[model samples]
Target: MADEKGRYSNAFTATLAGIADLFRKQKNAVVLSDDDVITGKNILITGASSGLGFEAAVQLARRGAHVYMACRSGIPEKGEKVMQHTGNRNVVMLPVDLSDIESIKKLVGQLKEAAVKIDVLIENAAVVPSGSRKTKQGIEEMFMVNYLSKFLLTRWLLDNNLFNTDGGSIPRIIFVSSESHRNPKAFDWDGFGKYKEYSMGKTVELYGYYKLLMTTYANELARRLNPTSQHRYSIFALCPGPVNSNIARESPAIFKPLLKIVFGIFFRSPKVAVQPVVYFAASSDVKDKTIDYLFLMSRKEMDAKATDVENGKKVWRLSEELLNQHGVVFQKSFPPRI
Candidate 1:
């Protein structure tokens, strides 16, 4: 019903929905204090080269966290900019193409070689392609970058024990998901990971579907990692609302000018839209919670499909199967509760 009212299946409708959502009065809104900080903690964030991810790096670095910018481009430049803006030399850049499995594996190996134990990992990288395309591994580009890569990367990190899960503090895993995840009616189980051709018209719809897969995985990750009464990790996800960013760079040229105008006038700037992300990363209010979701600084529940126990298990199983079919194997065992 909500999706039927304001489906984010198109750029125009999505923009309108975003603007309307922001103006609604927020209840139980959160406030981040100066005392809330992540000083000396190692934080790895993907897609840190631009948009919400870039601003998040700057703000988190400013809060005294050692920020690792995992990106496909902007290798040294973005890292340099974050350091210059935040005056925190702990910022470092690591390169990885989310569409390629080898690249994801290489990223995991690099962190292992460096002995970098992540205190917080923000899975922020995503793409809105002009059409269907294949990656180096021959999988659908959007499917890999938007959803499967996160599943693979998180598993690799956890299997290798890259998260700093010591008794000192809870390790946080944050997913930069979208409210558009609710647009999809249900899972396309028959075509789960199979590559298919699509045009720009289908991109936005698929984006929401991938976000659904991701949000479900986030729920599943929390369940698998912290099976006992004692919470071993903190898994969080949120929709930062409409960020005026380059995510729509793939849109047709005819609409670019108008889209830019609307985005500039209505959408929240990356600096302002990134508050919820910063809150999840640094605020003390969420550190103790096993899981939480936020939309524009207001707490909310994820879609029912994403939170369903059966759906979470099925997503986890199907994801593992898909990766195995692609010859990417998990080197270590998971927490064995399940």
Candidate 2:
């Protein structure tokens, strides 16, 4: 992988470099300590009840950003915890079930009614299922929870003009991806939302597949948004290298303890792993560099086959079709980037 000189000799080396950058003295690059870049900014983050999402919410709120914690349950308590921890009374919870489209619509309605202008949106909710499970809408649980719902929500938010509508500043849309995405093949277009060979190994494999979809989405959405120019928003994905969270709770019960020990010793804890996500959220280094797949606060090139423009378009088209089938309406053409 990395040579003695610390040069990236290959994909593995590049990956290791990214992870090492994660542990560097974490700092908010956008603000000079005497200044605050995120003060008064509005951010909506999913999966804010725990793990990387929760950590990012806390850090952002601490910086004076108004964070709307969107999760499936325990909103009141989690909101209170975040409020107490950050001393940011602006932190509030909004109910959302990433596995359900109707719930997403409800969230959009609420945001619209509240006239909330979002400056940053973090699509960070995900689940790893050990078995073949389906959502209430009959989609595979892993597919629904991990990628499709976020895809739909991002598109809906943009489609309905719920973000970056004002000419104030460049809004951002960040996707939480994983380095494991590099290990997967091109997305399974036809096989998605269908249980194909179900097993623990298959589930693990599919999790990477969904992450691949998420990685490609940043590129695809960037492509769609770049042409118009005035309404261009920052779009990128970050991989918080191997966080020791409940993400793997779906694994076999026997391996749970062993997995926790191995993860604790080998991988970074969720608290530390969240630095990259937080850094990417408001970092000056990434503000104009859109459509990046980052790890450890650095941009990493994706597999060519996965980042190909044709493949990106295909992914976007399929996502639109799926969402349309579920009754979402695409209203306006994309506007120009500022």
Candidate 1 lDDT, tens digit per residue, 1-338? Answer: 46443469887777788898889898779887778888999999999999999999999999999999999999899999999999999998999999999999999999999999999999999999999999998999999999999999999998888999777678999999999998898899889999999998889889999999999999988988788888889999999998899999989999999989989998999999999889988998887798999988989889999998888988888889999998978876454345
The per-prediction tally of clashing pairs is 0, 11
lDDT of each: 0.91, 0.74
**Best model number under lDDT:** 1
TM-score of 1: 0.97
Question: Across residues 8-127, which tens digit of lDDT does each residue of candidate 2 receive?
Answer: 233334335445645656443332232335888899999998888888888889888999999998769988988898899998799999888889989988888888888899999998
In model 1, the number of clashes is 0
Candidate 1 wrong stretches, greater than 4 Å: 1-6, 333-338
User: Each candidate's TM vs. the true structure?
Assistant: 0.97, 0.86
For residue 165, what is the lDDT in candidate 2?
Answer: 48
